[model samples]
Target: MRLLAVLDRVDTAPFTLEALAGLLNRLGPAQSRILHVAPSRDPDYLSPDEGMPDAAEHARFEHTVSAQTDTLRQIAQEWTQAVIPHRDTAWTERVGDTRTLVAREAAGADITVLSRPSPQDNAAVAEAFAGALYDAGAAVLIAPLEHYATLGLRPVVAWHPSHTLDLALQAARPILERASHVTFVIGENAPMEVPDPPLGAELARQGVAVHMDRFLLDTGDIGEQVRQHALSAGGDLLVMGAYTRPHFIEWLFGGPTQDILAHGTLPILTRHAPLVRL
Candidate 1:
């Protein structure tokens, strides 16, 4: 597997790097790359509405990047050495459009990993996420804010029937096949009458141990409910579809995917559905 870890901020990257290393261990020896894409130098691109960065803002941005450069390198070196004992790894930083750069890099990767977005750096994070999942059509692993040694040992799938879920399951098959145990949290949208859902049945055929439970939507916030159940069940990773609704709509009204990204603590394996054209 080729794993790409996209860093949004030097401070938050340790968790992402940890998750990347853990995923490398979980998925077996693989090539991994750590990438940081800075925003384009063009002032217009940086602030389209203003059409340029004010002198003070420009100075602050440059200072921030300069100050973080050494720290970024140190963290990258540490993680690179840490992973080198088990697999091949490298790190690089580039200045460009985040979305385009991330999409280009992720195109060659089996899975792209990223630090969960924070309020301070959400724009860049969102751009990178869009580039990887939406543009490159790649599966993304959003690392938890907290550190985790490893994941996929016991992954919980938030299950429902949809094209998005189908893609997510397919992308996560490697993890599922290797998991010690797999739990399916059946959403209210799923058919309850069936003793075995298609996904669970397929995993069972593959000799993977599987379990299931009901997740009624009306119970409360779906994201919170899923997170609690997974944690309570000892789940180390969360596997589910992302962004079922339009991105703008989700940003405005909120959706389960957004809710999970904002507050859930589990490392999430997710993929967006392909865009349809008339």
Candidate 2:
């Protein structure tokens, strides 16, 4: 699968490069593009009391935007130099509006990888990118800040009977194909009704080493149990479906899906889907 990674600056967190490289290795040396998005200047810089001619303001705004674009181009060049020597990977950097640039770069890509930004600095960029890619029907891999470098081939699938499971698995197919081992953790409180076993059989056919375990806990912390199981199994990646229940249900019941999204430290592959019925 072709992988696109969005990088602005060098990541300071440990293992970030390692994780990215590991993921790239699994994808088998496809073209990797690093898109650098530049911030646009505000055209509303004129004083409210002053009535400036429309044409003059437009010309000034264009000049400022052009200068900013040039600066971003230089930054992109420097970024390319820093990343090129570190790996045997192709790198390219383009500067433009982040939203539009990302969409263009991701157009034909099968998957995109994004590093989670610090909470303070434009955190919405990553989130917005994730949603845009998801809407575009591209698989997105979000690397967490803490464990970016240590993700290996060992993975744990957080299974449920919902349709989200299928989408999540499909999005993670590249990793699953390369995984040395995969464990499916079934929560104890998950509906007593089990899902169709065909998916398990299909995974086995793909040569995945699959194991199923029943998670049991009386403390009502299914999220904790899932994390513990993944860690115990030596899994570096957690594969699970994204939000499954309705908004109100999630608000009232506190779904395990939300809990994992908020608390899980491992790299997660998630896909949105409708609820699956037996």
Note the residue pairs that clash in candidate 1: none
- For model 2, give the 10-residue run with minimal summed lDDT: 244-253
lDDT of each: 0.79, 0.60
Compared with the true structure, the alpha-carbon lDDT of candidate 2 equals 0.60
What would the per-residue lDDT of candidate 2 be over residues 1-278, giving only the tens digit for each residue?
66666654344222334455667666565666544554353324435665554887767767865664455455445544565335444455454456666767766666666654444435235433643354444555656667443454888888776666677688687778777787888876555445535666677888888888676556756777898888788888888766644441242136655456556678776655534469
Model 1, span 1-278: residue lDDT tens = 78899877877888998888778777887788988887756333455666677798788877776667667778888877766455567877888788899999999998899888765554777788778888888888989989776689889998766787788888788889888889988757555743456778788888888999776566567777788888887888998887645452344236655667787889999888877988
Provide the clash count, candidate 1. Answer: 0
Error of 2 at 258 (Å): 4.3
10: Cα error in model 1, Å: 1.7
